[model samples]
Target: MSIEIKMPALSPTMEEGTLAKWLVKEGDTVKAGDLMAEIETDKATMEFEAVDEGVIAKIVVAEGTDGVKVGTVIAVLAGEGEDAGSVSAPKAESPKAEAPKAEAAPAPVAAPAPAPAAAPKADGDRIKASPLARRIAAEKGVDLSGVRGSGPNGRIVKADVADAKPGAAPAPKAAEAPAATAASAPAAAPALVWYDESIPHEVEKLSNIRKTIARRLTEAKQTIPHIYLTVDIQLDALLKLRGQLNKSLEARGVKLSVNDMLIKALAVALTQVPKCNVTFAGDQLVKYSRADISVAVSTPTGLITPIIRDAANIGLASISTQMKALADRAKEGKLQPHEYQGGTASISNMGMFGIKQFDAVINPPQAMILAVGAGEKRPYIVDDALGVATVMSATGSFDHRAVDGADGAELMKVFKALVESPMGLLA
Candidate 1:
């Protein structure tokens, strides 16, 4: 009995991945929790861990193959009593969910050819068809309801769908359009992008991370209505507080940065102005009670945001420690799915780079992102007199659909108040 191994979704956003490397090849035995392969997901390269024990019968998809859709078979594992040499890749991927399974249940052998008078074909009016069959049937306008399935238990496979046609096939077209648009349907796709080969240049395939960033940012800008608000914040007080706190915490080996303090400020502000702590779901708004701040960290592959959960409630020292660890792991492409996936809002600090000010794009689902710039000494008013104060520029990009101009302004007002006072963050 041979079980198929399929590509797994390492992250919620991963629809496909590049098979970076295979740790085990044909004839090697593996058990649950064993690392079987390195799969490059949208956010990171994660190891595919086996969930069962079996002999590697064959490698269905070779390493270095990118764009392998999640659930697509990548290997075959021979179970006990099965001849490893005889086990081969099946003609079609089992209609099972394509999650990476180091050990999947053995594929059902053809039920000893059904009797002359067998059970009814329909299973409660639900048609049983392999995913591939459903796809081809859709592309060719074949109707499964009328097509006799030739697979196990009278299930429809690709071969069964080949000749079936529907006079009113438009119905299948609507439901299966998404699957048909994959690379396999290249003939129907148009070449909308082309570059000059005449120019001296090198072309490289976009990594999974880069591809995801491109897609997400495009969607965020195109679909979300953006409103930008800028505020000049005095950072002198925050800087003084940070210096004082760092000295007190030096004994504990915890040092804090301006970004760390700002993370707390943003989280606190979200709670104060709960209206801005939201996500825009079509036709409804989701208001969050806790402030989970997603801090943007730049990695070699691309920018990834590892979240700081309950930033408003945690101490600055803890925030700093977690941020440092998360940033380190993110740069190494080692962050797990949960580490970078969800947040109530986001904050991006480019102050370290000395960028005076810039607007940041809002991470989808989250209503706003705060962009921080460098703090520099500038003349400012001190109690009715002109004096020098360290000032920084902060901009809030809001989703107008969910957060109104007034609400965003209130949130920024609270954030600035917290930073300017500094003591409020400690509380």
Candidate 2:
């Protein structure tokens, strides 16, 4: 009584998925609710759980299988003691004795079944793990196919490492720690080695996420006609407001930042300039009733934009809290696709990094993006006097198809006024 296990539709737009890994193997028992596999879709990687208790009868789709059509029978589940390996595994045609080891590890490195090559080869080095396992291993930076499995049918369960003691496995004989470091540490500069001058390094292909970013950016640039708007904002008043607020809250736990103030100001301006808080949805213009602003945070992987829903209605304290939480989540790679998507507007501030000026690519759907730079003091004609004023440069990139020059400039003007006036944000 074997039951077919097909890939579930994880998202509305998902038509295919890369089987990331199989949690269970032939003859391995599984219980309902147990996480059985990981699937990488176009947007995000998600876990698949068991729906029924049974032994894995067979895995039809091996890990690293790309373009696996939805609803395909990837595996089979059978009642206890049922022969699970009765179904023949799909065999792929080989070119070399084994396929060339350097063949790109597919667009997705994660799949639910074992890869065609039992040895997971990365950079021509043999790796042993399901595509799903390889993805997890790659993410965790663990050398897979290198570690022995302790699960039924010799499958590597995620918990095996959790229960293992350190220094238990045999050290690798194929590679050794740098001889110079293992023997005696080298001085400040080591004698020039022949390898240092002409060593050739192989560059691996970009991961799916990186490829998607490159593709999206290229599309945005080529498809959208971009117009840049630059404006200088006086920040002395805003800094003064922050200092006063912090002074009043010395006993309180909140310390304020200029970026937080900028967020608040931007939110206010978006609310005033409703046109800027809209996306260029083809066939019809889509204007949002609320300002859901995505703030770009730089992570080790790349730039991730986390949304602050209804940012116009939130206070500066709340904005700070949300930004901190999103930044932490972005660094951990725990944010979901929705958490990093669907914003009517976006903001990228490099002021803290001391960047004087920069232009940002408009995150699609959203018609405009604002880039903020470091604040500096400069001579200005204020009222009737020539005096020193702290000014910051902000640039806006707008989709010409969606936002006109007046529409874009109006948003910047509002932002400049609110930031310079400072009290307008509190109002």
Q: Which candidate number would show the highest TM-score if scored against the true structure?
A: 1
Q: After superposition, how far is residue 88 of candidate 2 from its true place, in Å?
A: 7.8
In the range 1-427, model 1's lDDT, one tens digit per residue, is 7888988878776898888889998999999899999899878877899987899998876676656789888899999889899996766434333222311211222333321111111121446665556656655556567788775446676667666664442232453343323312442222223766579986454778897799999999999999999999999889999999999999999999999999999999999999999999999999999999999999888899999999999999999999999999998878899998899999999999999999999999899999999999899997799999999999999999999999999988988899999998888
lDDT, residue 336, candidate 1:
91
What are the lDDT scores of the predictions, listed in order?
A: 0.81, 0.71
* C-alpha lDDT of candidate 2 relative to the true structure: 0.71
What is the Cα-based lDDT of residue 70 in candidate 2? 89
If scored against the real structure, what TM-score would every candidate get? 0.74, 0.66
Report how far off residue 271 is in candidate 1 (Å): 0.5
